[model samples]
Target: MSSPTHSANTGRIILHIGTGSFHRAHQAWYLHRLRESGNEHALDWSIAAGNIRSDMNPTHEALAAQNGMYTLETVTPDGVRAYEHIRSIQHVLPWSPDHAPLIECGASRTCRIISFTVTESGYYLDSRDRLDVSHPDIAADLDGARTTIYGVLAAILDARRRADGGPVTLQCCDNLRHNGEKFRAGFAEFLERRNLAELKRWVDEHTTTPSAMVDRITPRPTPDIRPHVLAATGFDDRCPVMGESFAQWVIEDDFIAGRPAWESAGAELVDSVLPYEEAKIRILNATHSCIAWAGTLAGFEYIHEGTGDAEIARFAGDYITQDVIPSLLPSPVDLPRYRDVVLERFGNPDIRDTNERVAADGFTKLSGFIVPTLRDCFARGASPSATALLPALFLAFLARWADGTLRIPYRDSLLDHQEIRAMLASEDPVAVFCADRRVWGELASDSRLVEAVRTASHSVNLWLAARHGVHNRK
Candidate 1:
């Protein structure tokens, strides 16, 4: 580990577990901006990033070839594109079978904080907020050595506890609402599963998990991004990332040891991250999903194209104005302005965010993003008319999957192919689909959701067919 006096390597360290493009464009970008602003303390906060999945080996090769430096390409709605070099990550170990390097980094005295971005499903959490030990990875990680979040975290914290590394914070940059609290519970429950009583005590006394809301529409980095960066910057950057011009991060100001003054780089350091998170989740995220699914049904390729379409645009607008905004009435957010900004960001043509990319994990998005609005509608005794359009759109999208009419592939980790087949074969497929608790929660049995979805699904099918018929005539 580098000491505080080490000029080249800096002082305080942040161990990030995933080297995904979103992290490159979002969290690490913030720290890089802090350093660029000539903040002396920012020099101490170099990131050491690695990966747990083999899928990230290509990303590892690309980034390591560049010494963790990458170009960020930003585009706005008016077709303006900009590029910048980002360099907050100073060291990376990549993915390896040996855990020595990661554990060593996590246990070091200078490593004040650790963060990760494995997306929502990567947490391996069930609806009840328990670790699904039955999962193959969790099962393998239980009594053996493996690299799931819990396994790696346990190994690292065990070393930290033994070394008396003082206090540290765990930051989950994933999009789960109440992410910090949820991940804290997950780690504790995972510790209980492992029976690491002593280490659990150490974590309870020393570690803090702070929630954050991060927004940046980072598309999956493909080979094209590399050449785009090269052409724009006169550098052959291998792992360049691209996003919309808009970015926002709001974090809870609860750190155990200490943290970088991230606000120096435009991040919001607030007493609570709830208002920001709720606004982003219900408005931005839910609307993002609505556009992805509805736009796919309308045969659009990219999210911007979908958000640009008149019908799809109205679908997203109605969702926010009619149902979601009402559910979140009298909140701290300036709803109207934020809504327009979200639309502008989404419709940025220069950013080619694929509907297939945004539309992945529909099952998870239904529960995590859209279902809360539905629940709120029922709670307030309001008709979920607009909210019901979301699920109706999703089910109609799934029909494209079942009928082999999908123009692009879609995948959801939690989706069951057999069950989908069964639903397609049922007398009332909409009713069968509505009954799945994973998608609808306890209200899966509610009759209003069933009828609303059924009517909406029929209307969606007709709309899609009409669009296709007109196209065929043309």
Candidate 2:
């Protein structure tokens, strides 16, 4: 283990919550690269990362033990592997149930940016982008619990206000649509619910939350990664991370306090991240879920396995070609080339991205990733048959999950287990699922969506029946 030492640079910090593989591989890697760029402003900033929950305590311990340094392993689609020792995270705060250390760090005047990656469903928003105040976690947070992001952030901001800490930016690095704006709205509403009118006003005047689009395919470390790291890098890195060689970050350039020169590290500082975010959500993210659910149903263990399957690849490719690309016409990005590149990246066998990991938050993915394209297509008087296959595959996957036959755990942070079970037990599960206001919103009553899902579900069933030997087998 590297000997722990204080950072020579001081006065500016980005306190990133959720020290998961993606955060380490994407944001932290960018900072590491920026520092290596020898830019004068690079050394003036560093990361202080921690998690809100105890589940990542092991990661925290390992990272702290290594003095916030770890090896990042990345592989290209052509099987080229590379390793870099990442030292961007200068401090790894110990986890506590109450988030005391996190709040303290976030409340510090020197901490100019507070960023997080809690995944799509962790935002606890409905299809209309409204915070679900009725959610158990949100409700608990409103009652002074610190289990959720809103709760923890509220505490942090409140302490910061009391300390008269100068302005800080709240940067959201999740895959959710308009992540920073949505987080601001949710946080505002959460404060309203908690009766913190003064704090809300203070936040309105003192902070700027910028939407960002972050992309990286960082998979959970498998059993063999540690041994490979030991042999290759001479470090027994307990908190090592692995990801695809491709990565991207597009952020709205609206920081209140001074910020890092991240553009030096290949990050795009944009006036608006909308076009890029929309393209990524509809094309790459939606198709990723489609392949994962389809692959899971086909008994494939990794994403590359499903992408390698001709039929599965056809379904995903057709979704992008037939619906998503047309819906996102005249985009700044070359949608067709982006789709091809995304597929090519997903087909990288060495990445070992798992179906279970990709397929976890299907409920959130349906609304956030797939529904926009369907809505746009319908608005333009076009059929979204190919796009419809994504939800159909998810519905089929949910059926396996409801029937206790799913090979892997189906974890949906936004899923209401009892409600889903009731829906699945209903007379027509597809119709019931299609009619869910939370998932379909105002489109729930639209017959076009219902009929499309019904038809696609049938096709999915037929496909699964033909692949019976591999269906849900380990």
Off by over 4 Å in 1: 1-10, 53-58
The candidate maximizing TM-score is 1
lDDT of 1 at 281: 86
Candidate 1: 10-residue stretch with minimal lDDT: 1-10
What stretches of model 2 exceed 4 Å from their correct place?
1-9, 96-100, 126-128, 132-140, 143-145, 360-363, 396-433, 454-474
Candidate 2 on 45-90: residue-level lDDT in tens? 8899989889988888999988899999989999888899999998
On lDDT, the candidate that comes out on top is: 2
Residue 61, candidate 1: C-alpha displacement in angstroms: 4.8
lDDT of each: 0.85, 0.90
